[model samples]
Target: MVSTLSRRTLLGGAVALGATGLLAACGRGGSPTSAQPGSGAWTFTDDTGATVTLDARPTRIAGLNDAIASLWNYGVTPVASFGFTGLADDVNFRGKDLTRVTEVGTTYGEIDIEALVAQQPELIVTHAYPKDSSGTLDPQKPLYGFADLKQQQTVAGIAPIVTIAMSGSAADVVERTVEFAQSIGVSQEALEQPRRDYDAARERLRAATASGLSVMAVAAYPGEGVYIAKAPDDPALLSYTELGLNYPDPGGSDYYWQQVSWENILDHRTDVVLYSLRAMSGADMQQQPTFAQLPAAEAGQVFPWEFSAMDYVAQARTINNLAEHLEGSRKVT
Candidate 1:
């Protein structure tokens, strides 16, 4: 699975994550992390079961871009995203306005400590996976993007760290993020509209999935062959299954994907596919041997696997998008 991980992709340690919006607030004495001289109004218990307390709710925060996408939907913006380098070109940031956010980590394995220090974040929020979904790397990395445990510890020195777990239902993960945002000062009023839209989207997906399209998710590599997503390891797939999606369990011992040779992909049955564009573009995958002959490809039922930015509105759009696509889809498997 490590063979498929590229620095440019969210598959770096994690991916089952996301959402968007901006909120302006400042932390204690304007420090990267501190109490509000004495008031201490901020405290939250994260998904990882860690409680974070601060003087005033952290106004200046630094975090992973994936979470930023979700918070952006609620207008609870961060001061910076550790992995951002400011490319506003639309790959669907889901309203994570990069223009107002600082880029603290310029590379995949490194965070710019100096840049993070400059942001004066009272708290640091990021995604954490106790086990590497890919199963090839160290499973102990407490946070995504940072190099290792020591690196995570190093960053924590600048500000208190809170982690959002990336495992489970995408909806559950997103709502957990919503709860976090609310704790940090985002109003329930700001979240209700998105919540309504998300609920509507789910109904649309439920209706679409009734058409019975056999679906699969995959990542194709040039020489390493194709990787079929193992549904049990994907929060997006898990959640969608509840929405009535017919995604099969592409079984494997690995944590997330089952690797098959180019020719071997023919053994799998699918009517529609959610391909990882980061692994290879749709045009390229269409040209691959054996893969091209699949019913999903021939019928143009391929879609991008984009659970990376999972705010409620963003996912609502994604759910509605697939439902819309099903309007043109047929049973080709």
Candidate 2:
């Protein structure tokens, strides 16, 4: 037996393992509860299940990782961002608007706590959670479960931390974002349009899947290792599968994606290589041995992607992104 499994089933089992007691805790107020504070401020559950309260709609925000990309997609401009080395030119938002934003330093591993505190942003967003090797949430400073929320609190002080899951379906992203906006005082009237538009985009992508193309998304430079963006039970892949393209089959217990080598990647024979760059440029990818040797590279089939597109919400936008990027490149037509 191949022993295929689903992440939802596993997480669901874990949820069930503790649900009875957790539910009791929730009823007794030991658990975090969602609350609306004001017209522009509210409280929502960060990914770590911690309650976060925003004082108001923040005009000054700092983003770590692709959270800025997600915010920009929502039309909210951030004042500053972390990790803008070779990427200051293009990817989505420009660093020119980020001058006043200040560099809070890089993302992942050890965060630049001092610079982040100096920024004094009203909002801070990141993508991963702060956990010890045990995978338990670090209790210090009330770290939010999600990385975006934790980074926000670290920078914004007492500002309500929000962790929007930018790695899910468009509807999932929109729903979470609306919940976030609502918590922060965005009125229903203001959210209705985006909610509708995002849903429309999702539907369009799903419908277009029938005509979808085979896309193999990975980091062009595999120095740290090649990252394959395949989520276990990720609905986003449905769009690609619908588009008639084969996404890389994930390894067991590997929900996020895989970091593989050029040898392992040959198993898929992926047609289109979607590459992600952070602090590096597309031109820099030529220096990578694996990337240089791949047939996809030899055929001029490599497509440069952004760090933001490597996550879950990548479905709705990445589809369109892949289609557009592929249009200009040579394919096996």
Candidate 3:
């Protein structure tokens, strides 16, 4: 089980003042110390072509659970957030202090309206995907940690929603998100180093991929099957392709992944395997008889990958991790 940071520990100085004072200090009641609401009104256009306007620069902010970490890294910590189930056990949040933020809900489509309203957020941030003609997100899939349209309506009643597009290349998404953060008062200075780090990491990965090593990104569903990620459908995978990593198209009608049985996993052979960190463990994969047959698996070239990373720091870390994995790997397929 993953250990969680407690509220008292994270908000040491403010905890002594009690919940009300702590909430105020955390940018809940009035303007944040770092960013004061300017004389002019604040407005932003979301990816869905919807414009959100505010009377004052929103100091009390709320976000989807996954988005909170990214926002915090960009110097815009949220006062409240809704998370997916088992969020406390997520390794990505380990050692991170989120105790000052109130958790509004634990699963998608389920929100604690009372708790959210209590936080009195003036702005809400989340990710948006391209919508089809029928008014559904592309691929008609549910985004992790995001609520459905009906549930979103409820939240909208409380505050204007600002969304960053989760589609397109990872760099595009990261850039747009940073732009959004800046519009809301996060300083460019705070974002400089992370951007520089990402750029440097990208160059390093590009050099590593020049060796023509093919990488296959996949998620294993222990008892069900394997879902091979396709570059065109995944932002992160597309960014990898742009960085020079060779990922073969899984040619199919599906916009996202190509589902394959465990027995046929080797059909899409490659030199390196970028497996999902959220899925079955590396030990579990190695224990499978079919997994033992793959050259990449046998050579131990599998590296953990997270497709949902939305911030510069996380993306930079991901690039560095991939570069390290490919350091001594050779083409095996």
The TM-score between candidate 3 and the true structure equals 0.83
Ranking under lDDT, best-scoring first? 1, 3, 2
Task: Identify the runs in model 2 with alpha carbons over 4 angstroms from their true place.
Answer: 1-41, 54-65, 72-90, 106-123, 129-160, 165-170, 187-208, 220-227, 233-245, 250-260, 279-299, 309-318, 325-333
Superposed on all Cα atoms, the candidates' RMSDs to the truth, in angstroms, are 6.6, 8.4, 10.0
Best by TM-score: 1
lDDT of 1 by residue, 12-87 (tens): 2332222101101111111122334467767775544456787687888777776776777677667877653332
Better model by lDDT, 2 or 3?
3
Q: Return whichever of 1 and 3 wins on TM-score.
A: 1
Tens-digit lDDT string for candidate 2 (80-126): 56542322543544443555345554432234667656666676654
Model 3 stretches with alpha carbons more than 4 Å out: 1-39, 131-147
- Put the candidates in TM-score order, highest first: 1, 3, 2
Clashes of 3: 0
TM-score (all chains, Cα) for each model: 0.85, 0.60, 0.83
